[model samples]
Target chain A: MKIARHLIAAAALAAAASPAFADASTEAFVEDNANEVLESLNDPSLSRDERTALFSRYMDEFADIEAVSRFVIGKYANRFTPEEFERFQAAFKKYALAVYENELDAYRGNEVIVEGSTDRTPRDSIVDTKIPRADGQEMSVRWRVLKRNDGYQVVDVALNVNGNLIWLAIEQQAQFLSLLDRTNGSVDALINRIERMTRDVVAGRR
Target chain B: MLCFGVTDRPPYVDIYLFIEVLALKAGQAAHICCLQHTEVIMKTVVSALIALTTLTACATTQDTTDTASGVSDPFEGFNRNVYAFNEAVDKAAIEPVARGYRAVVPEPARDGVHNVLTNIRQPVVFANSMLQGNAQASADTFGRFLINSTIGVAGIFDVASTLGVTEHNEDFGQTLGVWGVEPGPFLVLPLLGPSNFRDTFGIATDRALDPLTWTEFESDPDLDDHIAVGRTVLGLIDTRARLIEPIETLRSQPEPYIALRRNYSSQREAAIRNGETEADPYQDLPDFDVYDEESAEGTGAGDQ
Candidate 1:
């Protein structure tokens, strides 16, 4: 039983630590969605409706919404009632949508090049990439879209200053959990603080 | 041996006191960031600082002999129970949902959906390695971030083979290894699933590196019906997906869970990071120049 707990933690550690793998993962989707993706990328100007449509579809297709949700819930997950948990998820999602919605908007004009992705082969797999900068020169900017059966999604990205964002996610999850544990056995307080920050930002108080 | 000196801290759990101190420092760093994922950076940087020193100091011949010759094989009895429980989870819950998903969404559609979501995660994944002090992995993560966010359309990593960059795995368990922590024993979490104290700590440590943890909090009302269930359900699916194949390669015993634990321990410790995979699809990606969108595009955009 004790060992059971240990291995569960191992599984969690494995699940938590390793980024989930995808197979034939890179090329199939890109090849299939080439036109839809190309259309989305080529049109620099998208109506708010179009962007929202893309965002919604993209969210369903690529966001790892579950992992993100689990992270948002934090340790309090063990403590929360189902209703409370639902509330927590709702709040988290709204915060994310509100945040990234604007972010996608900023990328409206820059057309993305659909660099082809390779399959999950043994020796070599391709990194399908292209720079999104409008002027398109000497900008330390590029996007790697790995494909799978569903479609394509971005794994790592350089958002201006911070280069390695995904690795940062791992670091953040590890650090935050410790703090939450050190605190009053709940991520409630942290969630409140995040909410406060989000409200302040939305209100232009940041 | 370096004991935690606190029985209350959990037994057989020998994370260096320096790490305990570093964990505290990491928490404090998170406290300071009050902005983004700097908390994770703080923990990774601090842990790396300690790991580099500790690994070197522990590199002496005698210490090396202990690690090389230690027969404890910490994971001896733990993996059996946990692997069984994880299997139970797959049989009961995950498979059905995945089967449903497969039926509802054609395979191509399923992959597309997964790709789109995975891309958004590029930023998060890139930062995860930096916390481990993996310079090259971090660089590749950065390159992946750029290519995914830009070319792949808002953060999905498709350009794997092109840039001669290969995905180097990292997680809490792996991080524990870098810090010279032993795997100790395997255990299954009640609803959560397989782990050890070290890996549990690694799990805890890895959280600090999660971008979503620092940025978006998931309290939205829309995801109510399926989003919430979908996440965990898909998580289990993903879990089953990754482990199922690997399991076949291992010698499965009557106690499958225990076997899994032992296998992971051997595989993780023995694996070393470095050496880019051959053939690069991203080789054609044009030269990159740094562009700080958060700063130039608008300050406090994220905060807003």
Candidate 2:
């Protein structure tokens, strides 16, 4: 009887099948926007500030920054007051922008191809891509898109750096948590570190 | 009844058959007891066989995938031990020096060093490309080397790339693969992490082919030895420094060994394929999901 029940459950799971292909619109959406961002970065006429602003706007438009920010904070979310959370999010955006903005020039000559996508769950999908390098190598990038009430928003970006698939949000979580731990689990300490790091980046300090 | 315990030592199926035979010869009352015993034993035997068959099927599937991937690691036990040792060495010695090198060197200077090393490698690439009968790639590689050496300021700047002389990265292992040599058992050398038997052999051959190795030290043999040592040390440091971020990312994986193995094998296979679509070794492996329960929780707590 137990075996029969197990078989039935397995069959049910197999029946509620996910489509092999990712949602076409989502794939197109990511490819189009990623190209736009790359083009903006490559544009010689655009000033540094203008390019940064463009990147920021597009990033905010496509990326679920709030979801990422909350996710990074993890259980430490309770430690932050609403204002503190808002400040941290702002700081995070600046820090993330600073890091990515510095890397814009590196992406200038690369070609981005959206290979395909896989459904992670009912709500989430992963769009796979390959960025061919100048040195005759290829890098893989995956964008995690979550379906929201509005539309699909990118919650995370993962890079196959060398061979490792590194998720941006996960990396940030580690960094943020370490800072918090160092300050005796204080959220204020992490916020300060973020703000300081953002300031340093803005000032062109390493 | 004495036979029952003895038969239990054998497989349940054998015991069930034995009980059936006994039931045929025994009285009606004894036969009824045997019948009940056989029913219970039969169910157990059938379930056990089903489980055994399932396990065998799963094992066979795994073996098929491994075979299809063309990445056989017969010395997995030894390789894993070596891998662990290499990781320890990296953490203890190699990583600190690499980190220090990165901290001290300016970005452009580091790039210059990387460019120079890459330029030096072009001759090896050209030779291998020629060996593989890829004339166009060989020409391109030779052109890049010549242009970069002369106009690119000793290859400190990649001016050849601007002039449409793109890189053709070939190596002896790839050449061997092109010539239909099989990549034998996967290996992990002491410091050099993931490689295979064919690639390991290729490394030796490539070293022999290097111009630097053939340079005559007619006078000052000690200086030559020192120079050779310095070159190897610098190369090691440069490679390690470049890999710092990737290694850290790899270490963050739930199963670093498996992840690294998959990554290395796939990357090597891709290199061998050279932009040609081939069956991906990593295709059957589970997708890397960031929000997988264990990873999500672990990453959130900074525990992994």
Candidate 3:
């Protein structure tokens, strides 16, 4: 349910941004992306290693991480110079890839059926998808994606199964945003703090 | 029985099967005991079990906040194998795809696709800025960009940037921000970009009813359907291909998903509030002002 919403949101965000391709855009992108992705999925010759590599690319083409990053980074543009910003950009992309690569790797044969997109301004949409588990259990995962360009980015993923992970991300973002809102209306302090933590982790200080 | 569909994305599979077992067991016990409101309890449990199954797949770890409290970000425990998968694609898939599109499409057409996308987003952005009380002309500027994107250049170009049309990204999630909801963990969804729990919900609300179908789908997508779809999807692929190099930076941390969620979470808000720049609190900030160094040239591109 939650993951499904994420897919829907991605579609909605794409539709909202490119009103021109709203209804059928995903059908097109999916068919196109799936066509490319499914080729490898069908090749018995391919190993999971090969399949993972293949799907990752498909996912990249499917998602514009840099663009989405810029969209999400919205304001932090000013505090850093171009160089400093790029450093953060590097950090951001690495983190994004590290986070998502597994989920893509997890895509074996399970069909994630995308249902519909939502139509409301000022809100995110729910993308519906289903997971038919092997143990005679069927469930749903909705992807809550944000639309931008003619495509969408997954901003949050919800699992109707547990509802914990999706809720966890949202609840945390809200808390962090509040911190930013309260601190001179900027993310500087929080980012600064995170950077410090990151540095420590990288340096093995933490 | 919660007959589960076998799929590729899991950890969720194990969890879902487990819930199904729990529910079935509970139902059997309920039937034997003849508990009060058996049907209602069964439905509630079933619904919750079903709902819980979905929750486990939300691959995020934790949201950004002072570590005094908050769950650790899930990405902190990333599968290194997945990292390799991400890195490989950054090299193989996008390069060829980008090369293919660049060869076939005209630059103007490509830019037109880019522009049109930006234009439509201005209003949503304008609303975001207005909500934040961060900028003054946010709404009007958004409205102007909206018109230009929809009409000017036949809706081919995103005149917003040229005219300094800034967009803000406020949404139900940000509203929840106003209410101080926590952004759960950072999650990198397959096929979806990046997000967190709260924003995930925001994503759901954002797409509840697509306004585009009503507005854009009025006419037959028409005989040029394949061509039209190809052109646009290609335009989109071109856009995605463009980001591969930059997006790879997501792997720098153990918790890429959480990092991305934080960045995007903030980015969306900043866009909507039209974060005031030292140089232009009153004037709208240009799109991708800092990143697109090439476009940053005095194109003043922001002629408006």
Best by TM-score: 2
Q: Tens digits of per-residue lDDT for model 1 on B1-304?
A: 1112222221100111222222222222222222223344346445533543454444423211112112122332233344465567766876566556655766555555545444444454456566668888778767766676677665333665366665544554555566677755344433344444565555555555655444543686444334333533454453333233233322112223322332233333433222222133233221111111122211111110
Error in Å for residue B155 of model 3: 3.0
TM-scores of all predicted structures: 0.36, 0.50, 0.36
Worst 10 residues of 3 chain B by lDDT: B27-36
lDDT of candidate model 1 versus the reference: 0.40
Supply the DockQ value of model 3. Answer: 0.03
Write model 3 residue lDDT over A101-167, tens digit each, in one string.
4333244345556655433222234455565533444455555445566665454444443222222
Candidate 2's error at B287, in angstroms? Answer: 11
Residues B1-304 of candidate 3 have per-residue lDDT tens digits of 2322223222212222332232222211211111112233345334433544565576454442323223334443332233345446745775577667766888788767655644444444455445545465576655567567565664676455567755333454555555567767544332233444565555443332213312434365553344334434544464454443334333332234333434454343332233321232212212322434433321121010
Q: How well is each residue in B38-153 modelled by candidate 2, as lDDT tens digits?
A: 23324533443354345444432222223323456555556667789889998999999988998899879887876777787677778888999988898899999999999998
Q: Scoring model 1 with DockQ, what do you get? A: 0.01
What proportion of the real contacts between chains A and B does each prediction keep? 0.00, 0.07, 0.04
- Say which prediction, candidate 1 or candidate 2, comes out ahead on lDDT: 2
**Chain B, TM-score, each prediction?**
0.54, 0.69, 0.51
Candidate 1, position A156, lDDT: 30
Reference-based TM-score, model 2: 0.50
For residue A63, model 2's alpha carbon misses the true position, in angstroms, by: 15
Error of 2 at B68 (Å): 8.0
The local distance difference test score of each candidate is 0.40, 0.59, 0.43
Give the docking tier of candidate 3.
incorrect
